[model samples]
Target: DASRIAIRHGLPNSAALPIAQHKDYDRMFADIRDKLHAKSGDPVKPEHLE
Candidate 1:
C-alpha cells in the first residue's frame, strides 16, 4: 500500500525504487526531486497513480 506513494512519484519499475524491507524514502524522494529539478526548477507535483 505504501509503495503506491513511490509509484505515484514515478518510482515504479525504476532502478531507484526502494526495497520493501528496507525502504529509503530519502533516496526515493531525492531521485524524484532530482528528476523534476533536472527537467525544470519549477516544483511540479507528480500526478497520483491509479
Candidate 2:
C-alpha cells in the first residue's frame, strides 16, 4: 500500500512516489482507479482512494 511505501522508503506524506517504478504501492496506486472503478463504477475522487 502507499502508506506502507511511505514508511518503507521513508518518503514524505506529500510524495506520490513514481508509479511506473516499484511493484508494490507504485503499481497499486497506478491502477487504483481502474481496479476500484470496476467494482464501484464511480469517478474515484482523491479522498475515496484507499
Put down candidate 1 lDDT per residue, 1-50, tens digits, no spaces: 75678788877655554464355865786687785664435556655222
Report, for every candidate in turn, its global Cα lDDT versus the true structure. 0.60, 0.62
Per-model TM-score versus the true fold: 0.31, 0.24
Q: Write candidate 2's Cα lDDT for 1-50 as tens digits.
A: 88779678876554464553567875665587566664445556675654
TM-score of 1: 0.31
Task: Summing lDDT over every window of 10 consecutive residues in candidate 2, give the lowest-scoring window.
Answer: 12-21
lDDT of 1: 0.60
Q: Which structure among the candidates has the greatest TM-score? A: 1
The clash count of every prediction, one per candidate, is 0, 0
Top of the candidates by lDDT: 2
